[model samples]
Target: MITLFGVGCLVFLVVCALVVARTRDLLAATVVFAAYSLVMALVWQQLQSPDVAITEAALGAGITSLLFLLAIGRTRRTEDEEG
Candidate 1:
């Protein structure tokens, strides 16, 4: 049963990756990419890999996201529509 769950998470991760790829909005794509990392981290935790989970949380969910957001700052934002 757990194997099925792991498989499902893998499939969902793939879908999230596709979503990130297909999105034209940089911010939206970044958010989707973060979701992909978070889900992957959970999957790793469930598979008895706490070290991977911690690394994913610290790097994937934290530093990587901050860096991506910083990079995405070069793009226009919804708030800019008012100007």
Candidate 2:
């Protein structure tokens, strides 16, 4: 019994994943990845798993994304220094 809302979310998830994979810009990709995490959290919530959703929102969307941004900043600094 897959509803339209579920299908829409799945489509959006796939689209975001594709964008993240295809984009060359690290910052843009990171933002898209965060969006993908949020979509995943929403899917988990819809599936009746509040715990998983909250964990995904906190870790996946929040902490992991922040780490990635920080790493990207470091890499960019190193590249700028080298160049």
Candidate 3:
């Protein structure tokens, strides 16, 4: 049986995915993506995979987010047509 908490986490994950896809702002999208990664880490933890959870938290949420933020800082925040 699926637990209520699991369902809630799944729902939140989907919502975060949609928000990340729809948002044009790179910074906002990156923030949401980080949140999604953190939740994914939590899910991995609940699945009895502490190794995967720690790796995901460190790499997915931490290193990846930092790289994205650094890239965004050096580029345009939004994609706009340039003539």
Candidate 4:
């Protein structure tokens, strides 16, 4: 029962996942990962799971991305101090 829009979202999600995995930059990877999460949330919504979609949007795309960014920043600072 998948529509064209749903298929498109699936494709986009896969592409984003691949990009996140292949990217060398941590920040870029994190951003791509967040995008993937957002797409996933959309898919969940289309599937009629509003609660799961909201949770994914809030945690996966929001707090998780913020945490990754902060961690990356801290790691960069540590590397700078060591080198």
RMSD in Å for model 1: 5.0
lDDT of 3 by residue, 9-80 (tens): 889999999999888888999999999999998888777899999999999999999999999999989966
Q: By how many angstroms RMSD does model 3 differ from the true structure?
A: 2.1
lDDT of each: 0.83, 0.89, 0.89, 0.89
Q: In model 3, which regions exceed 4 Å deviation?
A: 81-83
Worst 10 residues of 3 by lDDT: 74-83
Using lDDT as the measure, name the better of candidate 2 and candidate 3: 3
**For model 4, what is the C-alpha lDDT against the true structure?**
0.89
lDDT of 2 by residue, 1-83 (tens): 67889899999999999998776778888999999999999999889999999999999999999999999988852223233
Cα lDDT of model 4 by residue, 10-48, tens digit: 999989989886667778888889999999999999999
Instruction: Quickly count the clashes in candidate 2.
Output: 0
Give per-residue lDDT, candidate 3, residue 33. 95
Clashing pairs in 1: none
TM-score of 3: 0.90
Maximum-TM-score candidate:
3
Residue 62's lDDT in candidate 3: 94
Q: What is the lDDT for 17 in model 2?
A: 94
Deviation from native of the Cα of residue 79 in model 1, angstroms: 18
